[model samples]
Target: MGPTRKRDLAAAVVAAAVLGYLLVRATYRYFPPITVWTGMSLLGVAIGLAGWGFYVRARIRDAEIGVGRGRLHPLAVARSVLIAKASAWMGAVVLGWWLAVSAYVLPRRGTLRVAAADSPGAMIAGLCALALVVAALWLQHCCRSPDDAPPDADPAPG
Candidate 1:
Protein backbone atom coordinates (compact mmCIF):
# COMPACT_ATOMS: atom_id res chain seq x y z
CA MET A 1 0.00 0.00 0.00
CA GLY A 2 1.07 3.61 -0.60
CA PRO A 3 1.84 6.17 2.06
CA THR A 4 -1.11 8.02 3.54
CA ARG A 5 -1.92 11.19 1.64
CA LYS A 6 -2.01 14.53 3.45
CA ARG A 7 -5.05 15.53 1.40
CA ASP A 8 -6.97 12.50 2.58
CA LEU A 9 -5.99 13.11 6.19
CA ALA A 10 -7.03 16.75 5.92
CA ALA A 11 -10.39 15.76 4.49
CA ALA A 12 -10.94 13.31 7.31
CA VAL A 13 -10.06 15.96 9.91
CA VAL A 14 -12.37 18.54 8.34
CA ALA A 15 -15.27 16.10 8.11
CA ALA A 16 -14.79 14.97 11.69
CA ALA A 17 -14.47 18.53 12.96
CA VAL A 18 -17.72 19.55 11.30
CA LEU A 19 -19.55 16.56 12.77
CA GLY A 20 -18.01 17.11 16.18
CA TYR A 21 -19.06 20.74 16.19
CA LEU A 22 -22.63 19.84 15.27
CA LEU A 23 -22.79 17.17 17.97
CA VAL A 24 -21.38 19.49 20.61
CA ARG A 25 -23.80 22.22 19.63
CA ALA A 26 -26.72 19.84 19.96
CA THR A 27 -25.71 17.85 23.06
CA TYR A 28 -22.85 19.53 24.90
CA ARG A 29 -25.08 20.26 27.86
CA TYR A 30 -25.54 16.53 28.38
CA PHE A 31 -21.81 15.80 28.28
CA PRO A 32 -19.54 15.63 31.29
CA PRO A 33 -16.87 18.26 31.92
CA ILE A 34 -13.74 17.89 29.82
CA THR A 35 -11.07 16.41 32.05
CA VAL A 36 -7.27 16.46 32.29
CA TRP A 37 -7.20 12.70 31.95
CA THR A 38 -8.39 12.98 28.37
CA GLY A 39 -5.40 15.06 27.29
CA MET A 40 -3.03 12.98 29.39
CA SER A 41 -4.13 9.80 27.65
CA LEU A 42 -3.48 11.25 24.22
CA LEU A 43 -0.12 12.60 25.33
CA GLY A 44 0.84 9.17 26.66
CA VAL A 45 -0.03 7.53 23.37
CA ALA A 46 1.94 10.14 21.44
CA ILE A 47 4.98 9.50 23.60
CA GLY A 48 4.72 5.76 23.05
CA LEU A 49 4.40 6.18 19.30
CA ALA A 50 7.45 8.47 19.21
CA GLY A 51 9.50 5.94 21.14
CA TRP A 52 8.45 3.15 18.79
CA GLY A 53 9.26 5.27 15.77
CA PHE A 54 12.76 5.94 17.03
CA TYR A 55 13.37 2.25 17.58
CA VAL A 56 12.03 1.35 14.17
CA ARG A 57 14.14 4.01 12.46
CA ALA A 58 17.30 2.81 14.16
CA ARG A 59 16.65 -0.82 13.28
CA ILE A 60 15.84 -0.02 9.68
CA ARG A 61 18.90 2.19 9.36
CA ASP A 62 21.11 -0.55 10.70
CA ALA A 63 19.76 -3.03 8.21
CA GLU A 64 20.03 -0.57 5.34
CA ILE A 65 23.64 0.27 6.14
CA GLY A 66 24.53 -3.42 6.51
CA VAL A 67 25.89 -2.85 9.99
CA GLY A 68 24.77 -6.37 11.01
CA ARG A 69 23.60 -5.26 14.45
CA GLY A 70 20.25 -6.88 13.79
CA ARG A 71 17.74 -7.20 11.02
CA LEU A 72 14.09 -6.28 11.42
CA HIS A 73 11.74 -9.02 10.40
CA PRO A 74 9.62 -8.26 7.33
CA LEU A 75 6.45 -9.20 9.20
CA ALA A 76 7.34 -6.85 12.04
CA VAL A 77 7.79 -3.95 9.61
CA ALA A 78 4.45 -4.78 8.00
CA ARG A 79 2.75 -4.82 11.38
CA SER A 80 4.31 -1.49 12.29
CA VAL A 81 3.11 0.03 9.02
CA LEU A 82 -0.42 -1.17 9.65
CA ILE A 83 -0.43 0.13 13.21
CA ALA A 84 0.96 3.47 12.11
CA LYS A 85 -1.69 3.86 9.43
CA ALA A 86 -4.50 3.10 11.84
CA SER A 87 -3.09 5.39 14.52
CA ALA A 88 -2.65 8.28 12.08
CA TRP A 89 -6.28 8.03 10.99
CA MET A 90 -7.57 7.69 14.53
CA GLY A 91 -5.45 10.57 15.76
CA ALA A 92 -6.70 12.86 12.98
CA VAL A 93 -10.30 12.14 13.92
CA VAL A 94 -9.60 12.76 17.60
CA LEU A 95 -7.68 15.93 16.91
CA GLY A 96 -10.60 17.27 14.95
CA TRP A 97 -13.03 16.37 17.71
CA TRP A 98 -11.08 18.15 20.41
CA LEU A 99 -10.39 21.16 18.19
CA ALA A 100 -14.09 21.56 17.50
CA VAL A 101 -14.88 21.46 21.19
CA SER A 102 -12.22 24.04 21.90
CA ALA A 103 -13.47 26.29 19.13
CA TYR A 104 -17.01 26.11 20.47
CA VAL A 105 -16.16 26.66 24.10
CA LEU A 106 -13.40 29.25 23.98
CA PRO A 107 -15.53 31.90 22.32
CA ARG A 108 -18.35 31.40 24.82
CA ARG A 109 -16.14 31.35 27.90
CA GLY A 110 -17.03 34.88 29.00
CA THR A 111 -20.78 34.27 28.71
CA LEU A 112 -21.00 30.73 30.05
CA ARG A 113 -19.42 29.51 33.27
CA VAL A 114 -19.37 25.94 32.01
CA ALA A 115 -17.73 27.01 28.80
CA ALA A 116 -15.10 28.90 30.74
CA ALA A 117 -14.41 25.85 32.83
CA ASP A 118 -14.22 23.53 29.86
CA SER A 119 -12.04 25.76 27.66
CA PRO A 120 -8.67 24.95 29.19
CA GLY A 121 -9.19 21.22 29.20
CA ALA A 122 -10.55 21.20 25.67
CA MET A 123 -7.59 23.20 24.39
CA ILE A 124 -5.18 20.91 26.16
CA ALA A 125 -6.87 17.89 24.67
CA GLY A 126 -6.67 19.45 21.23
CA LEU A 127 -2.93 20.04 21.61
CA CYS A 128 -2.37 16.48 22.75
CA ALA A 129 -4.37 15.14 19.87
CA LEU A 130 -2.23 17.19 17.48
CA ALA A 131 0.84 15.66 19.04
CA LEU A 132 -0.62 12.20 18.57
CA VAL A 133 -1.20 12.88 14.89
CA VAL A 134 2.38 14.09 14.43
CA ALA A 135 3.82 11.09 16.22
CA ALA A 136 1.72 8.63 14.26
CA LEU A 137 2.83 10.18 10.98
CA TRP A 138 6.44 9.98 12.14
CA LEU A 139 5.97 6.30 12.97
CA GLN A 140 4.51 5.69 9.54
CA HIS A 141 7.52 7.33 7.92
CA CYS A 142 9.88 5.29 10.07
CA CYS A 143 8.26 2.09 8.88
CA ARG A 144 9.32 2.70 5.31
CA SER A 145 12.21 0.63 4.03
CA PRO A 146 15.26 2.47 2.74
CA ASP A 147 14.61 1.32 -0.80
CA ASP A 148 11.16 2.80 -0.90
CA ALA A 149 10.90 5.91 -3.00
CA PRO A 150 10.10 9.23 -1.43
CA PRO A 151 6.42 10.21 -1.65
CA ASP A 152 7.20 13.00 -4.10
CA ALA A 153 9.52 10.97 -6.28
CA ASP A 154 8.50 10.18 -9.85
CA PRO A 155 8.51 6.55 -10.93
CA ALA A 156 10.70 5.57 -13.86
CA PRO A 157 9.03 4.17 -16.96
CA GLY A 158 9.47 0.44 -17.53
Candidate 2:
Protein backbone atom coordinates (compact mmCIF):
# COMPACT_ATOMS: atom_id res chain seq x y z
CA MET A 1 0.00 0.00 0.00
CA GLY A 2 1.05 3.59 -0.64
CA PRO A 3 2.16 5.88 2.16
CA THR A 4 -0.25 8.28 3.84
CA ARG A 5 -0.61 11.65 2.12
CA LYS A 6 -0.32 14.96 3.96
CA ARG A 7 -3.15 16.53 2.05
CA ASP A 8 -5.45 13.67 2.89
CA LEU A 9 -4.63 13.94 6.59
CA ALA A 10 -5.15 17.69 6.53
CA ALA A 11 -8.49 17.27 4.86
CA ALA A 12 -9.59 14.79 7.49
CA VAL A 13 -8.68 17.17 10.33
CA VAL A 14 -10.26 20.23 8.77
CA ALA A 15 -13.44 18.47 7.81
CA ALA A 16 -13.85 16.82 11.18
CA ALA A 17 -13.10 19.99 13.14
CA VAL A 18 -15.61 21.96 11.10
CA LEU A 19 -18.25 19.31 11.45
CA GLY A 20 -17.54 18.87 15.16
CA TYR A 21 -17.83 22.57 15.77
CA LEU A 22 -21.07 22.70 13.90
CA LEU A 23 -22.42 19.68 15.68
CA VAL A 24 -21.70 21.05 19.15
CA ARG A 25 -23.07 24.46 18.27
CA ALA A 26 -26.27 22.96 17.03
CA THR A 27 -26.80 20.13 19.52
CA TYR A 28 -24.42 20.06 22.48
CA ARG A 29 -27.22 20.83 24.87
CA TYR A 30 -29.05 17.74 23.80
CA PHE A 31 -25.88 15.67 23.73
CA PRO A 32 -24.40 14.10 26.82
CA PRO A 33 -21.51 15.75 28.60
CA ILE A 34 -18.03 14.94 27.40
CA THR A 35 -16.04 12.77 29.79
CA VAL A 36 -12.44 12.82 30.98
CA TRP A 37 -12.18 9.19 30.06
CA THR A 38 -12.54 10.12 26.43
CA GLY A 39 -9.13 11.79 26.52
CA MET A 40 -7.61 9.11 28.69
CA SER A 41 -8.83 6.42 26.35
CA LEU A 42 -7.41 8.04 23.27
CA LEU A 43 -4.16 8.63 25.14
CA GLY A 44 -3.89 5.00 26.10
CA VAL A 45 -4.41 3.87 22.54
CA ALA A 46 -1.90 6.35 21.25
CA ILE A 47 0.78 5.23 23.69
CA GLY A 48 0.25 1.59 22.84
CA LEU A 49 0.53 2.21 19.11
CA ALA A 50 3.66 4.28 19.52
CA GLY A 51 5.33 1.56 21.53
CA TRP A 52 4.36 -1.09 19.00
CA GLY A 53 5.39 1.02 16.03
CA PHE A 54 8.77 1.74 17.54
CA TYR A 55 9.32 -1.94 18.15
CA VAL A 56 8.41 -2.78 14.58
CA ARG A 57 10.64 -0.08 13.23
CA ALA A 58 13.61 -1.29 15.25
CA ARG A 59 13.17 -4.85 14.06
CA ILE A 60 12.84 -3.77 10.47
CA ARG A 61 15.94 -1.62 10.75
CA ASP A 62 17.86 -4.41 12.36
CA ALA A 63 16.87 -6.75 9.57
CA GLU A 64 18.01 -4.23 7.02
CA ILE A 65 21.42 -4.15 8.66
CA GLY A 66 21.64 -7.95 8.65
CA VAL A 67 21.53 -7.86 12.43
CA GLY A 68 18.58 -10.29 12.55
CA ARG A 69 17.65 -13.66 11.11
CA GLY A 70 16.39 -12.06 7.88
CA ARG A 71 14.27 -9.32 6.50
CA LEU A 72 10.98 -8.74 8.31
CA HIS A 73 8.03 -10.69 7.01
CA PRO A 74 6.36 -8.75 4.19
CA LEU A 75 2.90 -9.00 5.71
CA ALA A 76 4.10 -7.70 9.06
CA VAL A 77 5.63 -4.63 7.48
CA ALA A 78 2.52 -4.09 5.38
CA ARG A 79 0.28 -4.44 8.38
CA SER A 80 2.40 -2.11 10.46
CA VAL A 81 2.32 0.53 7.76
CA LEU A 82 -1.42 0.25 7.50
CA ILE A 83 -1.82 0.60 11.24
CA ALA A 84 0.50 3.60 11.31
CA LYS A 85 -1.54 5.33 8.66
CA ALA A 86 -4.81 4.58 10.37
CA SER A 87 -3.41 5.77 13.69
CA ALA A 88 -2.57 9.10 12.14
CA TRP A 89 -6.02 9.42 10.64
CA MET A 90 -7.54 8.55 13.96
CA GLY A 91 -5.36 11.16 15.63
CA ALA A 92 -6.67 13.75 13.24
CA VAL A 93 -10.26 12.88 14.04
CA VAL A 94 -9.69 12.83 17.78
CA LEU A 95 -7.87 16.13 17.79
CA GLY A 96 -10.49 17.76 15.66
CA TRP A 97 -13.31 16.44 17.75
CA TRP A 98 -11.93 17.70 21.04
CA LEU A 99 -10.59 20.93 19.63
CA ALA A 100 -14.05 21.84 18.40
CA VAL A 101 -15.53 20.85 21.72
CA SER A 102 -13.07 23.03 23.58
CA ALA A 103 -13.67 25.97 21.29
CA TYR A 104 -17.40 25.66 21.70
CA VAL A 105 -17.15 25.43 25.45
CA LEU A 106 -14.77 28.35 25.95
CA PRO A 107 -17.44 30.77 24.83
CA ARG A 108 -20.21 29.18 26.80
CA ARG A 109 -18.17 28.79 29.99
CA GLY A 110 -20.85 29.99 32.29
CA THR A 111 -23.86 28.69 30.46
CA LEU A 112 -23.62 24.93 30.10
CA ARG A 113 -23.05 22.04 32.47
CA VAL A 114 -21.31 19.90 29.88
CA ALA A 115 -19.11 22.69 28.63
CA ALA A 116 -17.94 23.72 32.06
CA ALA A 117 -17.41 20.20 33.19
CA ASP A 118 -15.65 19.01 30.04
CA SER A 119 -13.58 21.87 28.73
CA PRO A 120 -10.41 20.76 30.51
CA GLY A 121 -10.83 17.21 29.33
CA ALA A 122 -11.48 18.31 25.76
CA MET A 123 -8.32 20.41 25.67
CA ILE A 124 -6.23 17.56 27.03
CA ALA A 125 -7.75 15.15 24.54
CA GLY A 126 -6.84 17.43 21.67
CA LEU A 127 -3.23 17.62 22.85
CA CYS A 128 -3.00 13.87 23.27
CA ALA A 129 -4.37 13.44 19.77
CA LEU A 130 -1.68 15.76 18.49
CA ALA A 131 0.93 13.58 20.20
CA LEU A 132 -0.60 10.57 18.52
CA VAL A 133 -0.20 12.23 15.15
CA VAL A 134 3.47 12.83 15.82
CA ALA A 135 4.04 9.26 16.92
CA ALA A 136 2.15 7.87 13.93
CA LEU A 137 4.13 9.99 11.50
CA TRP A 138 7.34 8.96 13.19
CA LEU A 139 6.39 5.33 12.74
CA GLN A 140 5.63 5.88 9.08
CA HIS A 141 9.02 7.49 8.66
CA CYS A 142 10.73 4.65 10.44
CA CYS A 143 9.16 2.08 8.13
CA ARG A 144 10.51 3.72 5.00
CA SER A 145 13.21 2.19 2.83
CA PRO A 146 16.25 4.43 2.81
CA ASP A 147 16.73 4.01 -0.92
CA ASP A 148 13.06 4.09 -1.86
CA ALA A 149 11.84 7.11 0.07
CA PRO A 150 11.52 10.44 -1.69
CA PRO A 151 13.85 13.32 -0.74
CA ASP A 152 11.09 15.01 1.23
CA ALA A 153 10.34 11.93 3.31
CA ASP A 154 11.75 11.72 6.81
CA PRO A 155 14.87 9.74 7.55
CA ALA A 156 15.24 7.31 10.43
CA PRO A 157 16.39 8.84 13.69
CA GLY A 158 19.87 8.08 14.84
Candidate 3:
Protein backbone atom coordinates (compact mmCIF):
# COMPACT_ATOMS: atom_id res chain seq x y z
CA MET A 1 0.00 0.00 0.00
CA GLY A 2 1.12 3.57 -0.58
CA PRO A 3 2.13 5.86 2.26
CA THR A 4 -0.51 8.00 3.98
CA ARG A 5 -0.81 11.32 2.17
CA LYS A 6 0.17 14.41 4.15
CA ARG A 7 -2.24 16.52 2.13
CA ASP A 8 -5.22 14.42 3.17
CA LEU A 9 -4.34 14.57 6.84
CA ALA A 10 -3.77 18.34 6.68
CA ALA A 11 -7.06 18.87 4.91
CA ALA A 12 -8.92 16.76 7.43
CA VAL A 13 -7.35 18.69 10.31
CA VAL A 14 -8.27 22.03 8.80
CA ALA A 15 -11.79 20.92 8.14
CA ALA A 16 -12.24 19.48 11.60
CA ALA A 17 -10.81 22.58 13.24
CA VAL A 18 -13.12 24.89 11.34
CA LEU A 19 -16.09 22.68 12.06
CA GLY A 20 -15.16 22.37 15.71
CA TYR A 21 -14.81 26.12 16.07
CA LEU A 22 -18.13 26.74 14.41
CA LEU A 23 -19.74 24.06 16.51
CA VAL A 24 -18.48 25.52 19.76
CA ARG A 25 -19.55 28.99 18.65
CA ALA A 26 -23.03 27.85 17.71
CA THR A 27 -23.44 25.81 20.87
CA TYR A 28 -22.75 28.87 23.00
CA ARG A 29 -26.50 29.35 23.37
CA TYR A 30 -26.80 25.95 24.98
CA PHE A 31 -23.33 26.10 26.52
CA PRO A 32 -22.85 22.40 27.17
CA PRO A 33 -19.98 21.29 29.32
CA ILE A 34 -17.21 19.38 27.53
CA THR A 35 -16.99 15.86 28.87
CA VAL A 36 -13.69 14.29 29.91
CA TRP A 37 -14.84 10.89 28.73
CA THR A 38 -14.51 11.91 25.11
CA GLY A 39 -10.91 12.89 25.66
CA MET A 40 -10.21 9.64 27.50
CA SER A 41 -11.78 7.71 24.63
CA LEU A 42 -9.44 9.39 22.20
CA LEU A 43 -6.47 8.41 24.32
CA GLY A 44 -7.72 4.86 24.57
CA VAL A 45 -8.14 4.52 20.81
CA ALA A 46 -4.64 5.84 20.13
CA ILE A 47 -3.00 3.57 22.66
CA GLY A 48 -4.96 0.53 21.45
CA LEU A 49 -3.98 1.13 17.84
CA ALA A 50 -0.34 1.60 18.76
CA GLY A 51 -0.33 -1.62 20.75
CA TRP A 52 -1.96 -3.53 17.90
CA GLY A 53 0.51 -2.07 15.42
CA PHE A 54 3.40 -3.32 17.51
CA TYR A 55 1.90 -6.81 17.56
CA VAL A 56 1.49 -6.82 13.78
CA ARG A 57 4.99 -5.49 13.24
CA ALA A 58 6.52 -8.20 15.43
CA ARG A 59 4.64 -10.94 13.62
CA ILE A 60 5.67 -9.58 10.23
CA ARG A 61 9.31 -9.48 11.25
CA ASP A 62 9.24 -13.02 12.48
CA ALA A 63 7.55 -14.18 9.29
CA GLU A 64 10.01 -12.35 7.05
CA ILE A 65 12.99 -14.06 8.69
CA GLY A 66 11.30 -17.50 8.63
CA VAL A 67 11.28 -17.73 12.40
CA GLY A 68 8.76 -19.91 14.23
CA ARG A 69 5.42 -20.96 12.75
CA GLY A 70 4.00 -17.48 12.50
CA ARG A 71 2.70 -16.90 8.99
CA LEU A 72 2.20 -13.34 7.87
CA HIS A 73 -0.99 -12.98 5.92
CA PRO A 74 -1.11 -10.35 3.21
CA LEU A 75 -4.61 -9.38 4.29
CA ALA A 76 -3.41 -8.69 7.81
CA VAL A 77 -0.75 -6.35 6.55
CA ALA A 78 -3.27 -4.62 4.33
CA ARG A 79 -5.56 -4.12 7.32
CA SER A 80 -2.68 -2.70 9.34
CA VAL A 81 -1.99 -0.19 6.58
CA LEU A 82 -5.63 0.82 6.57
CA ILE A 83 -5.58 1.23 10.34
CA ALA A 84 -2.48 3.40 10.05
CA LYS A 85 -4.11 5.61 7.49
CA ALA A 86 -7.25 5.98 9.57
CA SER A 87 -5.21 6.70 12.69
CA ALA A 88 -3.24 9.42 10.92
CA TRP A 89 -6.37 11.11 9.67
CA MET A 90 -8.26 10.72 12.94
CA GLY A 91 -5.34 12.03 14.99
CA ALA A 92 -5.10 15.13 12.85
CA VAL A 93 -8.81 15.82 13.21
CA VAL A 94 -8.81 15.31 16.98
CA LEU A 95 -5.69 17.41 17.40
CA GLY A 96 -7.21 20.26 15.44
CA TRP A 97 -10.51 19.84 17.27
CA TRP A 98 -9.05 20.22 20.75
CA LEU A 99 -6.88 23.07 19.50
CA ALA A 100 -9.94 24.97 18.41
CA VAL A 101 -11.71 24.14 21.62
CA SER A 102 -8.72 25.30 23.65
CA ALA A 103 -8.59 28.55 21.71
CA TYR A 104 -12.22 29.25 22.53
CA VAL A 105 -12.01 28.19 26.14
CA LEU A 106 -8.78 29.96 27.02
CA PRO A 107 -9.98 33.58 27.27
CA ARG A 108 -13.46 32.85 28.58
CA ARG A 109 -12.79 31.04 31.80
CA GLY A 110 -15.27 33.14 33.76
CA THR A 111 -18.22 31.56 31.99
CA LEU A 112 -19.71 28.38 33.41
CA ARG A 113 -19.03 26.38 30.25
CA VAL A 114 -15.40 27.45 30.10
CA ALA A 115 -14.91 26.97 33.81
CA ALA A 116 -16.42 23.50 33.73
CA ALA A 117 -14.89 22.33 30.46
CA ASP A 118 -12.11 19.82 30.86
CA SER A 119 -9.37 21.76 29.13
CA PRO A 120 -6.74 19.53 30.68
CA GLY A 121 -8.44 16.45 29.24
CA ALA A 122 -8.58 18.14 25.85
CA MET A 123 -4.89 18.85 26.08
CA ILE A 124 -4.20 15.28 27.07
CA ALA A 125 -6.26 14.08 24.13
CA GLY A 126 -4.29 16.36 21.85
CA LEU A 127 -1.06 14.84 23.08
CA CYS A 128 -2.47 11.36 22.53
CA ALA A 129 -3.44 12.34 19.02
CA LEU A 130 0.15 13.37 18.42
CA ALA A 131 1.22 9.96 19.67
CA LEU A 132 -1.12 8.35 17.15
CA VAL A 133 0.66 10.19 14.37
CA VAL A 134 3.97 8.71 15.43
CA ALA A 135 2.34 5.32 15.85
CA ALA A 136 0.88 5.48 12.35
CA LEU A 137 4.26 6.36 10.90
CA TRP A 138 5.87 3.53 12.79
CA LEU A 139 3.23 1.12 11.53
CA GLN A 140 3.88 2.29 7.99
CA HIS A 141 7.57 1.81 8.57
CA CYS A 142 6.88 -1.73 9.71
CA CYS A 143 5.01 -2.48 6.47
CA ARG A 144 8.00 -1.65 4.26
CA SER A 145 9.47 -4.35 2.08
CA PRO A 146 12.34 -6.44 3.36
CA ASP A 147 14.43 -4.97 0.55
CA ASP A 148 13.51 -1.49 1.72
CA ALA A 149 14.61 -2.36 5.25
CA PRO A 150 18.24 -2.62 6.36
CA PRO A 151 20.18 -5.86 5.85
CA ASP A 152 20.97 -6.27 9.54
CA ALA A 153 20.15 -9.59 11.12
CA ASP A 154 18.08 -7.81 13.79
CA PRO A 155 16.67 -4.93 11.82
CA ALA A 156 14.30 -2.38 13.29
CA PRO A 157 11.96 -0.01 11.55
CA GLY A 158 13.50 3.45 11.38
Using lDDT as the measure, the top candidate is 1
Model 1 lDDT per residue over 79-111, tens place:
888888888898899988997899899899999
Model 1 segments beyond 4 Å from truth? 156-158
- Candidate 2 Cα misplacement greater than 4 A, ranges: 151-158
**Model 2: per-residue lDDT, tens digit, 1-158?**
67788788888888899999999889887866666666776777778777877777778777778896666677877777888898999999878887888889988879866678888778888888988887787777767765676757569856
TM-score against truth, every candidate: 0.94, 0.84, 0.77
lDDT of each: 0.88, 0.80, 0.73
Among residues 3 or more apart in sequence or in different chains, the pairs in candidate 3 whose N, CA or C atoms overlap within 3 Å are none
lDDT of 3 by residue, 47-141 (tens): 77778777777887787798966866878778888888878887898878887777667667667455446576566767777777777867766
Rank candidates, TM-score, best first.
1, 2, 3
lDDT score, candidate 1 = 0.88
Residue 141's lDDT within candidate 3 is 68
How do the candidates rank by lDDT, highest first?
1, 2, 3
